[model samples]
Target chain A: MPSLFFYLFTAITLGFGLLVVTARNPVTSALCLAMSFVGLAALFISLDAYFIGTIQILVYAGAVMVLFLFIIMLLDIKAEEGKKPNLPAVIGGVVLAVILALQIVTVSSSYSLGKTPLKNAPLSLNKAAETSVLPTISNDLKVGTLPDAKLMGLTLFKQYGFHLQAIGLLLLVGTVGVVVLSKREKGGQDA
Target chain B: MITLNHYLIVSALLFSLGMAGVIARRNILIIYMCLEMMLSAANLTLVAFSRFRVVEGLPDYAAQSLVFFTITVAAAEVAVGLAIIVALYRSKQSVEVESVTKLQG
Candidate 1:
């Protein structure tokens, strides 16, 4: 069952990702990107990171995509019908993509590449077996605190609370900047 | 069962597709959407790694939280980026990157 879901979401994500790039209409590309985001959110959920998955749907698929669509409408982008495909650019992209795929596959196949250093390190530092931010469990305990949405909230509030505030500030600044840059100057020009 | 490699392969494919989109698309909006796709692919890999790698027998929630922060940043980026695109369109009347060469002047 799990494998079935993993494959399904993987196909959805990759397929829509391709469509987003290839669709001639900007609006269609945006919509396909939204679908890709949905598939990505499902993939996150399958990994048991429920909070991130929900935020993926809410922030990415919902808010960010809506913003993209609004801009597309505002700009009134016509169908990109007459543009000639640059053969050199397409060929370069394909070659680079193939090289990247090969590199990632090669690097990922060696599972212990980054693990050896930790494997020899002290258990206290590397594993933190005795203590952590999450609720502690005995080594032989049948149940453990698997990182889920609840644990994620605790981690965010405890460890990253200040970072959250900083992000809020960044958002505020971005909002103001957008408003100022986009607003037409009085009696001058649309820009 | 799905392994970490499965997720990594998925992410790699998405990232490369996004790269292709960025290169092939003439429209700035489509290119920007492709950038968002690339970010999503990276986030997927992060969450997947956090899932399989156990520290002290507990899942690494920190990576998941990092993904959360990344999403927040992406939202802000899209808003500001689109606004800039709109502003450019108002003055230039087109969103093609190749045609907008005023920056070079």
Candidate 2:
């Protein structure tokens, strides 16, 4: 990825991220967050994690943001207009954020490995194909293509299959929990 | 040239922004959005490392798989969290953080 595009996406991600923080209205914050996620997905693609990037958009920008919007509209939350801001918390939050950012910058700058550019660590498709067990993966790599999704699928099923099933179970539990939590009580009694 | 540090810096800044939002925003829903942003920042870091660290002559797929699980879990979390928020709203009739002071003692 070119440095220009990297910076462009970085700006998009962080800029909208800042908006998400500062926007008074919840809906605006949610929309800005969606834009930030889209930019983040672009950054993932730049890293050559194509499948991750695609799902970042699909799950976050598509499904997740829609859920946020639905809840925001359903709750009928008005803009926090005329409310006095919590001065101490605001100051503390900004200071804490700055401190954390500076700490990461200092540490990463001194870290030797982070200095390497993408070009220096180019994917070795032919070499990977030579050792790959899956014929489809090997074939795609042999053809000078990066089969990102296929590789990810293989990794998940071959190596982390159990974890995948656990995630499925977690999702099922979450669904049941949501239904139970939101269900109206008999006789309209508050919990 | 975009080094791994560039991505790292971006991710760090993004994370900081999310942290600030979580602390400063009074709206519970926006706070949840900020939490998602922080999660995405972590995802960015993992993907960046996966790209920069080559394994077996290919980018490591392990980190990407972890990111996939993270996304799935985050989605489920959002569903449950929003449901909880709806219940809170139904009971308290407000989404402001100040409204949920029952446990503030």
Candidate 3:
């Protein structure tokens, strides 16, 4: 059932994602991208991470996409101008081909090599046992003060708070900068 | 031999496609959206790794936490990127990168 959700959302996301890339008009492409974001959020939901999915919709699809469309409107870009068929495309194409070939080679080699399973291992052995150990670290961080979510929250606020604040400040500055940059002189500063 | 490696290859494909979109497309808005898609592909890989590697019940949520930060940064990028695009449009009639080379020289 969850796998169904996985396949469904993945298809939807990747489909719209393709549309976003292949669409000619920027406006239509942005709209397609909004749809893709919604599908991605749904994919996150299937992983049982509801918070991330909801925030993905609210922040990315809702606010961020609106801003993109707003800019699209402000720019009033009808058709793309002087869109020279990227002659430099060969450089990028070669790079992509190399990267993808490397990936394919790596995966193919790894697959053929195969993972060695434990000899005569008990079927009762847990696969995920090693991963859950990190939570133990949080509890030992000064006793009962560290729940998983609380530890994560505290870490964000205490350690990474400045970076968060910096983003906000940067947004404010960018807003001011855009306004100032767009405002033109009245007199003949014109060419 | 459909395994975790298969999933990783798909993720890689999605990522490369996104990167190519950013590089090949002339539109700035599309470039930004492609960037988002690239990030999504990376997040998918992280989740896949966590699902495969983590043993149940230990409360390990590092991948989830990292994803949250990735989303936040994406939001900030959109805000700034849109503002710059708007400003650029107002100064110059077209949004194509080629046109902006000379400041009306």
Candidate 4:
């Protein structure tokens, strides 16, 4: 049953992903990409990464897609209705992608660790509670729940706090860079 | 009954599709969207590995943290990329990849 849902979500994701690639209109492509992100978020949830899944929806499907649509409308991009695709690039891309996919499938199928089922490596709440330092996290674990978001927050702040700060700096720089890049020159000259 | 391989296979396929899109599509925005798809595929792989690899009897939060960072960076990247694309459009007045041939030898 779970596998059924997994396959269903994967189909949804890949199908919409294909549409995003093939659709001529930018708005249609953006909407299909949003649907693809939603499907990918479902796959994340199936893996028990509930927090990641939620943010995948919030960030990718919600914020990122909206940004894309806004940009598409702002640019007033018309559909490539009559343009001929570069045929050599299309053929090469399809062939290369197929080869890469097959290689990945082959490697993953043969990987010993990947064959392990989720049930075989179940999360032991008692053991987690034993190892946990925080009362809230340990309490949740003790009560038979996986405090995913709390644990994620703890992990981010505890272990990767510096990295988190670095990411924040990166985002700030990105914002400034966008402002600079999009700002028009005052003297009617391209900078 | 799904194993880690199932997730990996899905991720691989998604990444391949994105690769094809990036290479074949002429529209810079669609190519950018494909890049986002590729990033999401990597996130799926990371989350799957995080779930299967238990640390302290719970799913490894470290990998999940990396996924979080990846998502953040990707968002930032999209903003910067789109801004550049918009700038490109202002200068060239076209989003087609075949435009902007000043660098071509």
Interface RMSD of each: 4.9, 1.2, 5.4, 1.4
- Could you arrange the candidates by TM-score from highest to lowest? 2, 4, 1, 3
Error of 4 at A179 (Å): 1.0
Q: Model 4, stretches more than 4 Å misplaced? A: A189-191
In Å, residue A76's CA in model 1 sits off its true spot by 1.7
List candidate 3 segments past 4 Å from native.
A80-84, A87-105, A108-191, B1-7, B53-59, B103-105
- The order of the candidates by DockQ, greatest first, is 2, 4, 1, 3
Quote the positional error of residue B38 for candidate 1 in Å: 0.7
Q: What is the interface RMSD of candidate 2, in Å?
A: 1.2
TM-score of each: 0.87, 0.98, 0.71, 0.98
Each model's lDDT comes to: 0.81, 0.94, 0.65, 0.94
Taking the true A–B contacts (Cα pairs closer than 8 Å), what share appears in each candidate? Answer: 0.69, 0.88, 0.29, 0.85
The DockQ-derived docking category for candidate 4 is medium
Over A55-94, each residue of candidate 2 has an lDDT whose tens digit, in order, gives 9999999999999999999989889899888888899999
Write the residue-wise lDDT of candidate 3 on A113-156 in tens digits.
Answer: 22322121111123333332455543443352224454356446
User: Can you list each candidate's DockQ?
Assistant: 0.55, 0.82, 0.37, 0.79
How well is each residue in A72-152 modelled by candidate 1, as lDDT tens digits? 887778887877877788788878887898888778877753332222322232244346444432332334334366667
lDDT of 3 by residue, B56-80 (tens): 4322356666776777777766666
The TM-score obtained by model 3 is 0.71
